[model samples]
Target: MPILEVTKITKQFGGLTANHNISMHVDEGSITAVIGPNGAGKTTFFNMITGVYQPTSGDIKLNGESLLKLKPDEVAKKGVSRTFQNIRLFGEMSVIENVLIGMHTHLKTNLFGIFLNLPATKKEEIEAEKEAYRLLKYFGLESLLNEKACNLSYGAQRKLEIARALATKPKLILLDEPAAGMNPKETKELTEIIKRMGEEFNVSILLIEHDMKLVMEISEHIIVLDHGEKIAEGNPKAIRTNPKVIEAYLGSAAIH
Candidate 1:
C-alpha cells in the first residue's frame, strides 16, 4: 500500500471551496511534489492531511488507517509530521530545545514522574536529549545547540524546522514551501537534504513548492493544481510538456 492515500478529498468554508475532490497517493520512500501558482489550494491540502482542517468529503489513509478525524497531535503520533509555509519555530527557545519538543510523542515520562524526579523519568530525559542532539548533528546544526532559534541564519532556520519535523520519527513528512525565502545556495542544500531525508532516513515527502527548479529536480512524481483542482500528475518530463499544465500555470517559457 502507498504510504498515504488521499481519495477525492474536498474542503469548503461555507460557499468558498478551497479544494475540489482532490486525489493523490504518496508512495513509500518516495518524494512527491505539489505545485501551482499562489491560491491554488496547495496549503489547504496540507492542512487537511495534517488535520488542521476537516475535509467536507472523502477519506485520507496513512498506512491504510483513516486520518480524516484525527487531531493534529494525533496525526503526528500516527507518523505524520510537517513544517509550515512560514517559519514557525519557538523563537525564544534554544535550537535543541525546539527539536526536543518534537520528540514529545515518544517520551515515556509522565508529569507525576517528573514532579517527583523518578529515575525512569530522568533516564527518559537523558535519552531524549541524546536523540535530539543526534538529530541536530545529522542536520549539521550541532554547534548551534545553545543558540536561540530566532538567532539562526535564514537557511539554518529553515533546516532547523525540517530537523524538528524529523525528530517526530514520522513515516511521512509534508513540507509547505520550504524554499520560499531561500537563496540559491540554500535551495541547493535543501534539495540535497530533502533527497537524503527520503533515501537515508526512509521518510516519504509531500512537498508544496513554487520553485520549478527545485520541484522538477527533486520530485519523483509531480502533481499540479490550479484554482483548487488538480490539473496534472506525472513525472517531470511529462509534466513539463503537458499542454494543460502549461495553460494552467507553467507557461511555455518555464520548461527550460
Candidate 2:
C-alpha cells in the first residue's frame, strides 16, 4: 500500500476553491514532486494535507488510515512532518536547540517532572540532544550546532529547517520549496541529500519545487497541478513532454 494517499480532497477559502478533487499517492521510500504554476493551489493542497487548513471535502490517508479529522499536532504525532517554503526557525536559538525543539513531540516529560528534575525527564532531554546532534551531523551542520540559527548562511538555514523536520523521526516528510533559495551548487547538494534520505533513512518524501532540473533529477514520480486541479501525473521524462504541463507553465508565463 502507498504510504500517503490523498483522495478527492478539496478545500475552499470563503467562496474561492483552492483545491479541487485532488488525488495522488506517494509510495514508500520514494520522492514524489508536485509542480505547478503560481496560484495553482500546490501550496494550498499542501496546507490542507498537513492540517494548516482542513479540507472542505474528501479524505487523506496515511498507511490506509484516515487522517482527515486530525488536528495539526495529531497529524504530526501520526508520523507526518513538513518544512515550510519560508525558513521557520528560532533565530536567536542555537542550531542544536532548534532541532531539539522538533523532538518535543516525542518527549514524554510532564511539567511537574521537568520542574522536579525527574530521572525520566532528564533521560528524555539527553536523548533529544543526542538525536538533534545526529541529525545536524547528517546534514553537515554539526560544526554549526552552537551557532545561532540566524547566523548561518541562507543555504545552511534551509538545511537546518530540514534537519529540524527530520528530528521528528517521521515516516513521511513533506518539503515545500526545499531548493527555493539555493544556488546551483547548493541545489545539487540538496538533490543528493534528498536521494540519500530515501535510500538510507527509508523515508518517503513529497516535495513542491519550482526547480525543474532538481525535480527531474531527484523525483521518482511527478504530479503537475494547474489552477487547483491535477493536470498530469507521471515520471520526470513523461512530465517534461506533457502538453498540459508545458501549456500550464507557458500560459502563465511561469518557467519551470
Candidate 3:
C-alpha cells in the first residue's frame, strides 16, 4: 500500500477553487515529484496533505487512516513533516538547537519531569542530541552546529531546514521547492541527498520543485498538475515526453 494517499482532494478560497479532484499516491521508500506552473495549486495540494490547510472536500489518508480532522501538529506527530518554500528557521538559534526543537513532539518528558530534569528525561535528551548531531553530520552541517541559523550560507540554511524536518522522524517528508535557490553544484548535492534519504532512512519523499533537472534525476514517479488539476502521472521518461505535460509546463526545451 502507498504510504501517503491523497484521494480526490479539492480546496476553495471563497469563490476560487484552488484544487480540483486531485488524487495521487506516494509509495513507501519512493521519491515522488509534483510539478506544474506557478498557479497550478501544487503548494495548495501540499498544504492539504500536511494539514496547513484542510481540504474543502475529500479525504487525505496516511497509511489508510483519515487525516482530514488532524491539526498540523497532530499530523506531524503522525509521522508527517515538511519544509516550506521559504526557509523557516529559528534565525537566532544555533543549528543543532533548531533541529532539537523538531524533536519536541517525540520527547517523552512531561512538564514536571522537565522542570525537575529527571534522570530519565536527561537520558532521553542526550539521545536526542546525538540523533540531531547525526542528522547534521549526514547533511555535512556538523561543523556549524553551534553557529546561528542566520549565520549559515543560503544553501546551508536550506539543508538545515531539511535537517530539522528529519529530526521529527517522519514516515513521509514534504519538500516545497527545496532547490528554489541554489547553484548547479548545490542542486546536484541536494539531488544525491534526497535519493539517499529515501533509500537509507526508509522515508517517502513527496516534493513540489520547479528544478526540472533535480526532479527528473531523483523522482521515481512524477505527477504533473495544471490549473489545480492533475494532467499526468508516470515515470520520468513518460512525463518528459507526454504532450500534455510538455504543453502545460515543461515546454519543448524540456526534453532536449
Q: Best candidate, TM-score-wise?
A: 3
Sorted on lDDT, best first, the list reads: 3, 1, 2
Which candidate do you rate higher for lDDT, 1 or 2? 1
Whole-model Cα lDDT per candidate? 0.92, 0.90, 0.92
Q: Report how far off residue 49 is in candidate 2 (Å).
A: 0.7
Tens digits of per-residue lDDT for model 1, 1-256:
5999999999999999999999999999999999887899999999999999999999999999999889999999999999999999999999999999988887788899989999999999999999889888877899999999999999899999999999889999999999989999989988888878887677999999888898899999999998999999999999999998888764767644
lDDT of 2 at 104: 85
Q: Any idea what lDDT model 1 has?
A: 0.92
Clashes of each: 0, 0, 0
Best by lDDT: 3
In candidate 1, what residue range of length 10 has the lowest lDDT sum?
Answer: 247-256
- What is the per-residue lDDT of model 2 for residues 1-256, given as tens digits with 9 covering 90 to 100? 5999899998888999988999999998889999998889999988887888889999999999898878999999998999999999999999999998998888888899989999888998888888888889888999999999999999999999999998888989999999998999999988889989976666899999999888988898999999899989999889887889889888533433
Lowest-sum lDDT 10-residue window in model 3: 247-256
List the candidate 3 regions with Cα displacement exceeding 4 Å. Answer: none
RMSD of model 1, in Å?
Answer: 1.2
Ranking according to TM-score, highest score first: 3, 1, 2
Winner by TM-score between candidate 2 and candidate 1: 1
40-92: candidate 3 lDDT, tens digit per residue: 99999999998889899988999999999889999999999999999999999
